[model samples]
Target: MVSIIGHHLINKEEGYQILLYLDPQLIEVADEFDESFQNKEDLRQVVNSYVKNRLPDLKVTVIRVVLGSLVIASIPLLPGTEIKDLDSSQELNLKTEVKEVFENTPQEIEKDLLLVNKNNSLADNYTPLNLIVPEVPFIFKGFHEKKLMAAKAATALEELFAAAKANNIELYAVSGYRSYQRQEVIFKSQVEKHGLLQANQISARPGESEHQTGLAMDVTSPQVKFKLVQEFGVTKEGQWLKEHAAGFGFIIRYPEGKDAVTGYQYEPWHIRYVGQEIAQKIASQDLTLEEYLA
Candidate 1:
C-alpha cells in the first residue's frame, strides 16, 4: 500500500504541486505532517534521498501530471519538457513558460514596520487593520482572536510555516493579535503570580504589546509541549527560526542578552514581522526593534 500526499506551492488554485507517495511503512510517518508543504528544492532533495535509500535499483522518471480543472504552473521542468496531462473534460493545453514562482511582494513598509514596545505604547482603542488568520497550524482549536494577524503578515507567516514543513520542522502558532484588554488581563495575572517587578520583565502592559500590532506571533513546537518558554530557543524548530525567520520577514523580537534594550526578558517564541528588508537588517546587525529604529 502507498500513501499519497499533495500540496500546492502557491494559492490552492495555482502554482507548483508536490505529491508524495510513501510506502506502507512510511505512511505512519507522513501521516503526522499537515496537509501542505513547500520549499520545492528542499523537499525534492529529501524525496530523492528517501527513494535512493529505499530502492537503489529502481528507475525513477520525473514527470509532471496536470489534473482536471487544475491550472498548474511552475513545474520547474526545463523548456520543451513534455508532461503527462490527465484532464477530465476536453484536451489539456500545455504551456511550458517558466515564470517565477512564489514571488510575494514584501508587505508595505510603514504600517507593517511599526515599532511597538514598553516605551512605544499604542492607543487604548487601537486595533490593527486587515486582521486575518494565517493558514498555519495553531496550538489551540476553534475560532479565537489570537489566531488573527494583519493580512500581509499572515501571508508571510504562511510562507514561513510552509518552508518549515519542507525542512521537516514542525512549528505551531500559539498566539497572535491580542487586544489591549486581553493584555491587561494577562499582565495582571502575571503580576499576581510573580510580583510586579517580574511581571514587568515578562509581560507587557495593556497598550505596550507587540501583539496589538497584529505583526507579532508566538510560535512553538511539539517538542516543547507548545509552551512559551526560554528552553524552546534551543529546540531544532526554534533554532531554525533564528537562522531563517528574517528571510521571510520575521525576527526574534527579544533576543538573549538584549533584555535591557527590549524592556523584556528573552522570548524566543515571539516573532515580529517587520517586512523582509528591515527584518534582515535588524537580524544581521543583532539589533532589537528599538535599537534599529533609533
Candidate 2:
C-alpha cells in the first residue's frame, strides 16, 4: 500500500534541513520543489494538502512538528486554529511599541476615569494612595498673602498666579483640603440631597476625593461678577484656564466636552495636581488622564 507523509522545517540556512519521511522512503513525488512560504503556518498548510491528496485512497495520519526557530510550530487539525504566539519575534524587536503609541494615554481609557500620575495611573481604580500633604503654614481659605504655595503645587500655583496677574486675570483660590470626616459629610450630603449621580459630580467619595490629599484646589476669577455660574467658563479667567492651566501642572479636569470620560460634566472649576512633567505630557499628547492610563 502506498503511503505519504509531510513534515515542516525552519533554520535550514544554519546547516538545518527539512526531511520528509514515510516509515519507508516514499520517494520524492517529484523533485525537492522550491516553494516560498510567507510564514510557518503557510508551509504547514502546503504540507497537509500535499499529504491528503496523495493518500486519498487510504487512511493516513499527519503529524506536524517544529524543527528550529519554529519554537511552537504545530497545529494538528484545522478545527480550532489559534495564532497565540503571534509574531513573537517581531514583538521582541519592539516591546515598547504600546508605550510610544500612548505617551500621554489617559487613565480614562475606559471612558470614566481621570488620569493622575505619570503612567496615567488613576486615583480611582489604583491601589493605596500615596498622598503627600504639605504642612499648613496656617489654616486659611485663599492662598497666603505672601504668594507662596506648598511645594510642587505651591510653586506651580505661584507661576499660575503670576501669569494671571500679569494679564489682569484676577485668579482666586476658592477651596482646598478636607479631612476624612469632612469628606464623609460631603458624600452624605450628596446621597441625602439629590442622589448618587449628582453627588458624585460635585463631591468624590470620602477616600477618593483629591481634597483629602490637600493637593487639589478649586480656582476662579475674582473679577468675574457672575456668582460662579455654570457658564462661568465663558469669563476671562475661565478662558485663561482653558488655554494655560496645563502649563502649571493643572488640567481642567472634566473639560468642556469630556464629561463622559471623566464621569462628570465639564467642571471649569475642578483642577487636579499632576505636576509639570505629567501635565506637559498630557497637553502635548492632547489626551485625558483616562486615555493615558488606559
Please, what is the TM-score per model? 0.63, 0.50
lDDT (Cα, tens digit) per residue for candidate 1, span 10-84: 212322232222222332333223224333334334344433332233222232211222222122333322222
In model 1, where is the ten-residue run with the lowest total lDDT? 2-11
Where does model 2 exceed 4 Å of error?
1-150, 223-229
| Candidate number achieving the greatest lDDT relative to the actual structure | 1
Candidate 2 lDDT, tens digit per residue, 110-193? Answer: 112333321112222122233333332222454532222235665566677788778878777665555545666878988899
Q: What is the lDDT, from 0 to 100, of the residue 6 in candidate 2?
A: 24
